[model samples]
Target: MSLSPILDLAGLTLEVNHLARGVRFYSQVLGLELARHDEAAGVAEFVVNPHQTLTLWQPITRQANDERLAPLRPRGASHLHYAWQVEPSDLEPSKGLLDAHGLEWQEINLGTEDRPDWTLYFFDPFGHGLELRGVDRADARQPHFAPTPVQRPPHALPVMGLREVALAFSDYPTMKERLPRAYGFALAKEQEDRDFAQFTLGPHPEPDGNGTPRRWLYAWDPQVGLADMLGGDHALVRFYADVDAVGALVVAAGLPCLRDDHGLAVRDPEGHVFEFIAG
Candidate 1:
């Protein structure tokens, strides 16, 4: 079957408590290249690749004059989850690097379900959950046996291309009802609540050329309770032309901005937390 024209995974923007410290870690350790830094706006971008980007801004200290952070129980993290591609051979070496850095992670074995065999899950210095998976398999019944030679490429954190965002939510059903009402998203697909639910948001036609629009999924996290305290209790996926586009959306929505930590801030519809911003 043809695939739908899914939303391009454009990258994620996060708030940092210390700008210099944050930059130092991601650059020196992860080898990410800085594309831009605007001290005036207190914003910086790490090029993840040609299309993907990671933006970091100063943290919010004073209570927001605009909106408040979503009011939910702390899930003991500030991690924004993202998945990356890896090769079978590189897995061991990559894990070594993670170990050297004292990063903790879990191994998720696919067992020949998808083309990829193993996926390594870990958290960044800032606690963002990241997954790197082998692009190919090594099983006897699978395609290849020999490990492919690979080379490390220069890292770029550009604006991420069309991709999906796994947003954390406190209530799946409430999100299912309130998200569609507050934003312009039509439900595309859903899975049983495994502590979360995935819902499609946005407009991009499917690959069949039948004009079935592309959309994004909102993955709910029941462990997260700060939807109100974080200001954006609910998360929705959509495309923005740039940072300006992000501002425009907030204003247009008529949602009150409870807090602004420069690039990362909280806006409210009572229970939604809009944290990830991209162009």
Candidate 2:
């Protein structure tokens, strides 16, 4: 039997040093509703779809002699790169909304002038990179990944569902080679601009017997690998699985896997953690 990890990218959880600031950006700026927030607990959830959500959390409380904190490193410090996909037409309106708020933003085109799909990028108060990618409504573009209009708070734009997220790495071959070995993700699409490689977790048996996630993981090397340009680590990925099968396969793969109160999880070569929760 051909083996796959039986994974999915249901949602992402980002860590912010300043929980209040993060919550403000995602709510007041992004226009996502504040579904639930517990400031005392330092965690908040934003609804995207009934199934998809964005969570902002703070570092777990530090204990005495926490091994998680290295000699010189800060406790639970994380830098992440994240993106939300939206329809092409929303681009100009979204830009206008951001400008109206006096937020600094910039655009970078990933395609030709006549065939542009631009990405608008900015940052949160603590420096976590945030992106909004516009995928044109062309037949060649996977409609499944194209984001549709989402319900938003009266304060912000109609931020849609996630379509693509990019990770920057120092070595292409290492990531390209390890992705399949560590997990079942493999190259699914290519960019004509030669800026990045797209990997995906194909449809698998949804653990809950419901809709599976349609998502993409992009790896950008060398040209954009500069530390100041991209971020990694502290990004969340939810994978639904046949627990028995995944547990056995994880042990068999022996690829730095871990478990917690949630479920099994494994990180990509770049230290970006993926949390495998129940389908």
Candidate 3:
């Protein structure tokens, strides 16, 4: 079989209670440029990088007669966990900004003692868990993990792009098997206890060197590690992939999937929605 049709993570959407407050927190506080905001649609999009976007969506209550807007309306998840890639030099400035806004944050080292990669963990106004990851590029595990430089204004945070997005499942065993079997994701790393795993999609620059994939998805059992505190109900994740090829694999695997002219969407056992769009 060929490698997974998934190219990379295209975008992430968070469900927010207030669209205006969400816009202020992401734009004024985090320094992300508000690319577009549609009040009628109750959606706001922020450009994370050239290929990636972060969106905040306020779900509207559907009326009994509003069947036409059902397919067009998207639902978002709350209290989800996601991370952004930042330069090492921006770590202190990030703290300053978070402090200035009176937001409480915690600093931790996710890397080794000799080569430490610091991460700041904090919550948005809506209780969504967010991370600012300053990685050490010299780490031997990911030699090919080079992020493109993003030109930002003076007030903007030094965010390069998204590093990873995590999802917690009630049935970890099924997710462990189904994601790889249906999506062509390669197992990159896993915990000794088998409660958490990291799956990688897309190809690497050097197929023979280091063996690190371009993008990652972190999956874990509910109530394990950070998922215990940050996991939300029914979050939606979107990716850039070959929709037709992925849809074929999902059908061949006997899993339920929805297909249309735009893209393919599938739901896991835990109700997490995975939407694949053609790149």
Candidate 4:
């Protein structure tokens, strides 16, 4: 059993300059179903999977007038890097889709010869970095979260849901220490050369099978290679977890915890917002 209260990444909200353009790219090109759109509020929500959401927000100047929303307003990072998990078979089709849209894409193999883990990297219309990761599975790994029935769009890229989200940190060491202490994250991988680290939350099974944790949180210095591409300073990253435990931990670690209608939230040193939602 995992001691961490965080179960999974619940949603991600990105800041976009043009809401319509963002919506068209995600819905028409990526095939994510648009769940809700509030034109007046300048927000669009897309169903990434049964349990996850991808939201686009166009910041309004008058948002400060609404006290309840001002704090919760989606001010996310620009050129943020996030990934979606796909089946190995879907990779080629994804390439075709990108090419058809005249979008430039790059592919990299992260796994070995016998088992290949391929990642296709591309950008959205707004320049947010996006990735499609596919791995050949000889043995099926047990899922950490229970399967929920969802109606996927026929033209969608067969995305399994969010695989990872990366955050650019101005002070990587401080943020790194606080995450494990406050959120019960265990360091899974470290690329010191790149000044990046991957952290895993909740119970992970082992060398193979059910022990492998699929979801990841990647933290890297903003000065690093791909991190430099991130234009915005902050983003709203949310997770499904025990709100009480998360709140307590945040306070104990000397981090400021803010609570509103959206549960508990804390800002990292770089101003990136982390919100915890009760499952």
lDDT (10s digit) by residue, model 4, range 148-182: 32444655556667867888887777877888787
Best by TM-score: 4
Prediction 3 TM-score vs. true: 0.84
How far in Å is the alpha carbon of 244 misplaced in model 2?
A: 5.5
lDDT of 2 by residue, 1-279 (tens): 254554445666676877788888888888776788877666788887655677777766653112321222222224566666666677778888888878778887756777665767877677667777664445333323344577776558666776545666677777776665555555665556665667664443111101112456767763443225464553555655545566665567665666666676665446555556666
Task: Report clash pairs, candidate 2.
Answer: none
Distance from true position, residue 216, model 2, in Å?
Answer: 1.4
lDDT of 3 by residue, 1-279 (tens): 456677777778898989999998888666777899977777899987777888888877753111222443335767788877777788999887778788898888766787566778888888888888775455454422256657776655677777778888788888788887786666667778758877765643122112122456778876635423456557777888878888887888876667777588776657777788888
Higher-ranked by lDDT: 2 or 3: 3
lDDT of 4 at 211: 15
Q: Estimate the overall C-alpha local distance difference test score of candidate 4.
A: 0.71
Using lDDT as the yardstick, the better of models 1 and 3 is 3
**Segments of candidate 4 deviating more than 4 angstroms:** 64-69, 72-74, 135-143, 146-155, 204-213, 224-232, 260-262
- Candidate 4 minimal-lDDT segment of 10 residues: 204-213
TM-score of each: 0.58, 0.74, 0.84, 0.86
